[model samples]
Target: SSAITKSTKIVLNLESLGSLPADEAGPLARYASTIQAQRHDYNGKVLSIRTEDLKSLAIIYDMSPDELTTRLIEWGVLSPGADGSIYTDED
Candidate 1:
């Protein structure tokens, strides 16, 4: 329950944004596409996750928040954030 709550918190961090361009494929894009393809119901449409989303995904995927964040960073899914949220480097 607590874990799920924490995870939900992370999931909620996700930001619902427009889809990336077809040729703009990257690790983060791929990951986002995969999550979208899974058909997870998110307000009746696919949604994107943000840094806050990491915690929930980690709990659901049985990964540590730090570990998930590290993997995302390694895979270029998440870029270093000077502030509280991660910024996707579209370059």
Candidate 2:
């Protein structure tokens, strides 16, 4: 959760969605969708992910840290050494 960086806090108005479905087949899947939706004005763009942040993402997704990091790099969620540049797949 902490992987989201301090910047996400600035963009998103984080508050409880109120009564989310925790009994869903996959807790994280539901939570992920709801969490991603929590972002105000988000448009399928990259997030703030430093190298140290990968571990948190991996734990959230239940994947190896490196795999999630690699996928993010592939999906352009993260670019090494870039400063606050947001990218989308269509770009």
lDDT of each: 0.47, 0.40
Query: What TM-score number comes out for model 1?
Result: 0.40
For candidate 1, list the clashing residue pairs, or say none. Answer: 7-56, 10-52, 10-53, 14-49, 14-50
> By TM-score, who's the top model here?
1
Tell me the tens digit of each residue's lDDT in model 2 across 1-91: 3333434221111122123244422443344455566755344332322444445556876778555544544433344334433223233
Model 2 TM-score, 2 decimals = 0.32
Give the C-alpha miss distance for residue 10 in model 2, angstroms.
17
Against the true structure, whose lDDT is highest?
1
Listed per model in order, the count of residue pairs whose N, CA or C atoms clash below 3 Å is 5, 0
- Each prediction's Cα RMSD? 8.4, 9.3
